[model samples]
Target: MARIAVIGAGMGAMAAAARLAVAGHRVTVYERSATYGGALGAFERDGFVFDTGPGLLHLPAVWRDLFLKTGKEPLERCVGLTEVDPASRHLFADGSAVTLPNASRAGIVSALESALGAGAGERWGDFLGRARDAWDRSRRPLLEEPLWDDWQVLGRDPYPALRQRRMLRTRQAATVTEVGALELADPRLAALFEGCALAYGLDPRRAPASAALLPYMEQTFGSWYVAGGMRELARAVYERCLARKVEFGFGSEVTSIVVRDGRAAGVELAGGAVAEADHVVAGADTALAAGQELWEDGDVRPQGGPDAGQLPGRFAVLLGLSGARPASAVHRSVVHSPDTGAEAAAVFGGRLAERPTVTVLRPDDPRIRPDDAHEAVTLTATVTGHGGAVDWRDKALRERCAEALIDAAGTAVEDLRARALWHEILTPAETGAVPAPSLAGLGGRYLHPANSTRLPGLHLVGGHAHPGGGLAHAGMSGALVAGLIVEGADFRGSQ
Candidate 1:
């Protein structure tokens, strides 16, 4: 049995550890933090709770498959997983609104048509049909398997754009922004189409038409909320790893990757102690940043800085409110910004929009709130990452941003400002980790580096690696890494 050394106790790392252990490998995970679940964290104060990371989970089959593979116990048995109905309620800037039903195409269309007008739903439904085509074309290579060696083929856009005659030449959408403008035809529908990309911190203007896969997946598969918090999902995975006899070294930070004879020999910890292993898998971005040379020249380098797969810093305003959450309120509501173009420029350009799009999450779970009489609300927005043009560290700036979000939430929640007993602002500086999902177009600018590295016995997993980020993608990443190690490079994917 190969002794595998994994870096980081993040979801991806833990997932890999569990699978490797089940495969009879002696896996030891080294974590820098005291806890698992890198971005999947929670905040608790005076009985009020909030998920510091993603509020809703899409593509839950990824985790369900993990549970099915790792243990006899299913995912539902571990967490109170339920589909969030009225998938999302969107509050447009023009005061129009619509609550889309969970995973029901007809329901979503009818609701959109009722709210926005007769043709609104039809246009969106048609767009979704096309988006479905995109999903079918890109699903396997992008999500279900390891990234292709000639990933350039995957770089070629899979989104089949409807060609239109413009003068003497036929035209098709190159970017999602164009797709919205040309096909959706209405500003609201356009916003709905673009919002999907923005939710992943990708600018719609630059995001490839293939990004249609994400929204299509969400509408078809449905969005879900964990009972306790997203952290519970992480807890379930960690427990599964322990169940498989995977060892963990919490508080033991990997200082460097120890290489001997041009192969990854093991990992050196923070205190100069070396743990020898047959293979090393990096499930966190820390390993990439901590050791750059491990990746030889021409390897898929994880880029940083503004606009280079560097996600906009998240500005989350967690509100502890005094009234019971209204039964009529949907679990998630997105209050759209009046101007998406300007908002995109501000957010991606290292500046903050005065009126940014805010996603308000009000979970019905009692565990997150003090009681039924009180409610816990989380308002999140994509702004400039910390140390950019906007200083999230500035208290006054943060307060102003919080106030702006409260103003936005007021559109969705009644008495939002007045109901708040207290408010806590989590800036990009505070919550450093943000979601980054892999997209399949724009010449593969959004695709992550391959899982296999230049050096033998070294593999990559997690958001920064192949298949990209997001909870579901991270799980898929772990499965892919485990497959590569267990079955060799010939492993195609999950059948």
Candidate 2:
């Protein structure tokens, strides 16, 4: 059995720890906080509970597979899982809205036709068809496996953008923005298409058309909500790791990864104590692992493009409402900004939009509320934070941003201000920005570093690593890292 030291008690780290332990490796997880679940955090006050991280789960089969691999009990047995019907309701700035049915293309197409116009749904459906093609082409290399050494091949966009002929000039939609305008046509439909990209902090103007896979995955797999809170998913994974005999050191922060003979020796703690291991898996930021130099020279380092440093911190505003959730409420809704272009510019420019696109999540779970008379809701928007340009620490600034979210969310929740008993704002200061899942285009700028780094015994996993972010992709990150470690780098994921 090999002694493996995993950094951070995040979901990805714990997933790797569990799988490694099940493979007979002695795994120890080191987290700086007093708890597990890096980005998966929760807030509770009185009887209200809220997920500070991702509020919904998509492609839950990933976690289901993890649970099955780690133990006999499946994911459903560990946590209360329910499919969110009407996957999401989209409110365009044009005052037109459409409620998308869960996992039913026909239903969604019909709904869009009713809400937008005769050919609107057909156009959106056509786009989804192309998006599905993109998903099929890139699913293997971009996800479900280790990022290849020749990842540059993925730099070529997989999205089969339609060739449009205008007079003598032949035009093909290259970026997501062009796809929305030249293909989707209607401004409302365009916002819905680009809104999916914007939610991940990807600027629609620059994000490659392959980013269409974001909504494709969601529509195909459907959205799911965990009972209690999303934090429960973290708890279940942490418990699974424990059951697999993976040890955890909660309050133990890794200062550096000790190197011996140019391979990963182990980890050095905050107080200079070393925990030696045969291999090291970094499920957190590798920059801080060894003075921001661990990935220098010939290593597959983190990308720092125009949207760099880190993806925009998921700016969340948790609301504690006094009224009971309406019986007709959908699980989630996206309130598009009046001007998405300006909104993207503001986020990338280190500012907040006057009317930003806001995603409102109101799960129909009693575990999150004190009683049927009360409700807990979360509103999220993507904004720049990695750079020091935006000061999130300022209370006044946070409140101003929170107010903007509340105002923007008014479309989804009636009398939102009056119904609120209290509110909590999570800025970049508390949660830090989250990386989106790797996209298959933009000259591979959207792809994450390979899980197998140039550092021999050191591996990178989690949202910031291969397969990239999002709950499902993070699970894949853990799996890929474990496969590489256990199978000696020849592992190419499930055949």
For 167-236, candidate 1 gives per-residue lDDT tens digits of 9998899888899888888888888877777878778888888888888999999999999899999999
Candidate 2 residues lying further than 4 Å off, grouped into runs, are 288-300, 305-310
Candidate 2 on 363-416: residue-level lDDT in tens? Answer: 888898999999899999988774568888888888998999998899899999
* Model 1 bad stretches (over 4 Å): 286-299, 305-309, 433-435
User: Would you give me the overall lDDT of model 2?
Assistant: 0.87
lDDT of each: 0.86, 0.87
Measured over all alpha carbons after superposition, the RMSD of each candidate to the real structure, in angstroms, is 1.7, 1.6
Return the TM-score for each candidate structure. 0.97, 0.97
What total of clashing residue pairs does each candidate reach?
0, 1
- Candidate 2, residue 311: the lDDT equals 63
- What is the Cα-based lDDT of residue 445 in candidate 2? 82
Superposed by TM-score, candidate 2 places the C-alpha of residue 152 at a distance from the truth, in angstroms, of 1.4
lDDT measured at residue 360 in model 1 versus the true structure, 0 to 100 = 93
Count clashing residue pairs in model 1.
0
